[model samples]
Target: MTEYGPRPVDRRLPTEEARDLMTLVRELADREIRPTAAEEEDAGHFPRATFTLLSESGLLSLPYDEEFGGGGQPYEVYLQVLEELAAARLTIGLGVSVHTLACHALAGFGSKEQRTERLPDMLGGGLLGAYCLSEPSSGSDAASLTTRATRDGDTWTLEGTKAWTTHGGVADFYTVLARTGGSGAHGITAFLVPGDAEGLSAAAPERKMGMKGSPTAQLHFDAVRVPDSRRIGEEGQGFAIALSALDSGRLGIAACAVGVAQAALDEALAYTAERQQFGRPIADFQGLRFMLADMATQIEAGRALYLTAARLRDAGLPFSKEAAMAKLFCTDTAMRVTTDAVQLLGGYGYTLDFPAERYMREAKVLQIVEGTNQIQRMVIARHLAGPEKR
Candidate 1:
């Protein structure tokens, strides 16, 4: 295994505190994450201890309000931290994004009492979270989900299955959306369910091409009861809350995509400079040099696009269009850049002996998750031209 790790990113952080935070993140990634990533991923071992450490260090709560035990960092700063973590390991980076997404509904829309009692422990108390929305029959058409949450006085009985859940069986809590009224989007409602709630169960983790250490499983809710206090918003507001969370979550995915692309480019750069070909380094060849240059340029463009969206979010602007654009372009860039990286490493890239193959496999999922790139195009077009006709 050739020495391969993330290169130092030249970020334009807003404050000295943020810069110091980045330094700490890099040190932690280099020492704790990068060293064992390949081996652990190969063995399908989840790093629960690393996530616990992150919770203790305040990284898990960076984008929430400090009043609730969060770090109170701007979206810009929080996303850059995500990028750094993703550069080290996709499982860790994507897991953090999912956990943050799970917290969005309660943090943004829960009653004052709910926040006062639950937010503190959730944000920094070593609790992991998962978001439950997509179901066995519904993926892109989320409005058609069949999960039911029927109210019985002060309690609600939830019964449904959630597919492709990131944390699945291992999380401490779940932010779940279920149908509480008639059909379609307006019928949905959000609830915060404890992982150990009676009748809650998870299927085995899916066999995946990459990020094997991150569990992706289906969850079954068989008459799981949740108190009305756990309801995130009004009975019919779940879809809106879900969409709001996704707008920000898409930015997190964009940043992670850029991180993966950056890592791939760094690996290509390292290999090309050292591997001799025709009595000189292959990097000396014009063909490979141009490929490397293109990879770097794409990584920079993706980073800029995601950051621009993050800044818009930080500034309290309507950033849905920008978020969709960033998710679409950055993920596509990751797929392209990682493929080119494999080509640059030639046969060596395809083997498990190097990390380039893993990068390429991991990049494919970013395009599919958090609204497929095709769905993102529809979102951007809707913003530009208004909703489409039936």
Candidate 2:
């Protein structure tokens, strides 16, 4: 129960309120989302129904202002919802995360009029969004993006490609970054493009080892026209918007990692407690017990790190480096925890009969997305260097 206040102001609240929201989120995740995660993932089915249910429950826009039909919750609370969602279904959780990321560009930079009119559908109900930034030639160096946005009288005609869009085909809108002037980041501009805009087409979804339920594809924009009002901030401000949004997005990914590690720990604990070995339950083994303790401890530590970063951001403090650090720590923790969970279960864990393997696969992607662990390290090191070369 964070006290209501103007945004970016850290507030005091009871832990119980966040706990209550977590309880509600968990119920939906475990009961509704988890059951279908695996099968639909295998079949590459989209979870449009889950998004609708989330919208109905007001979970999709938990961090926005109440005036726009949002839950008016703090980022700290909103991220926990993401954690609970990911623990059950990574794909749906990611879908929610990217949607939030898409909203950030508009929320952080758009005019009051834009927020009042456009934020309702995206921040409330019956809407989905994608953040489009990474291009084929520009990933870590996103400033080098070559997407062209030529102004044709009052309308902007965009021509370029966006790689690794989380909801490439299914999203209702996209927060896209393109080149509006000369080369480099200073030329970049952000736009909110509708899904059905003429000349906007998505490539076939990429074949991936995990997160199949969440569609990932390349978006191609060929002379797509948009109203000038769709511009999200001034031209050349897109890079800043993208980077800031990713700072929060990294925290979202970190929270999901914590949830995943905890889920793997839960599965390992229950399995060991029931399975017998040499006249004693496998849970009685001291070696395995120590492994579980480490996993639990890591998950707890990761949770603390991410929450600390979220609080810092809420306080209007400098938290970009901290966010990267949390993302790096938590995703690595998930990868290790899930792998250990599988080892504890032996052969069963190696197969799809159990959830451990799926968790293991999902963990790998979190490390790569929202900026790779390598990129996170760079961010941290640059912050450490003060204002000199960072």
Candidate 3:
């Protein structure tokens, strides 16, 4: 019996350590994640224990600095690990991405004192995280967020709601962005808030078409107070921090999309080679063969696109534009390739019996998350054409 998911992906990593990391990730994915992914997803199970296991294995902290309890891996290697986990189960992949996004503000902009005090627990302390930037009225327009944080003496009180938060209710901490100055992007600031802070609560998770195992909900803050020491960066620097985080976060999304597309292609290839059609294998048909070839090609192209952007990021070059392009192209590829995988499977693909339909549904969200593909095009165009005139 051939494995119907997560085929080997030849990678060009810069270090032998990275090669070993990938091997461990694949072994864990096959043993701990893949065999039960469908069942757990169907049950809407969050797999908190699995996240703890990942934390203990150092998988959750691969891309950050080693001084802060991270693995200190390059972006390229980290993204490949994300692709592997995502290929097995998207909830875990996207979960790790969001957790990293939540840590970005403190890791990149927090003071030395802050890092010394709090960095260890966030990286590998078995505590999950959530990023709170998008509001009900502001997603693509993140700077227009209305969540307010009013400073009083040495503390700040946060009020208003944050929407579309992944890991909303379950996270141990939240990296929140709120209006601390005026109305525009310059007025925003970031804060690290504990999950159990007074006056902070999460609404029921959204009933979505896919990714049910990962919770997405609204977080309400009514006069929640935190000490000034918990604030990340300077006042009115939150938008810049949020944008920086999104640039990296988009690459994570791109990697995950390729994983899903790769998984779908693997399933289609296995099924086509076995299922007989009119005394011949379906894989023998020229038309079916072409579709499989196209799917494989698309997955490869998407993987390469994301990897190129990741290398630029690791080299300390400006990668926002390339990240946007990768996010846009890779997600679209996942959507197209997964749809073709369904078609290749014929009647069996439409039902829940096979994973093709699930992959198709999951791929749709990748286009919409980490900024919609439409928003990505706008970012890329602005980088190319420059920002619009007043």
Best by lDDT: 1
Per-residue alpha-carbon lDDT of model 2 for 94-168, expressed as tens digits? Answer: 788998999988888999999888998998767999999999999989999999999977899999999999999
Screening candidate 3 with a backbone cut-off below 3 angstroms (N, C-alpha, C), the clashing residue pairs are none
Indicate the TM-score of model 3: 0.98
Once superposed on the true structure, which residue ranges of model 1 sit more than 4 Å away at CA? 1-11
TM-score, prediction 2: 0.95
Q: Lowest-scoring 10 consecutive residues by lDDT in candidate 3?
A: 1-10
What TM-score against the true fold does each predicted structure earn?
A: 0.98, 0.95, 0.98
- State each model's C-alpha RMSD to the native: 1.2, 4.9, 1.2
- Global CA lDDT of candidate 1, please? 0.94
lDDT of 2 at 213: 82
What's model 2's lDDT at 312? 91
**lDDT per model, in order?**
0.94, 0.87, 0.93
Per-residue alpha-carbon lDDT of model 1 for 262-343, expressed as tens digits? 8898899999999998899999999999999988888888888988999999999999999999999999999999999899
Error of model 1, residue 327, in angstroms: 0.6
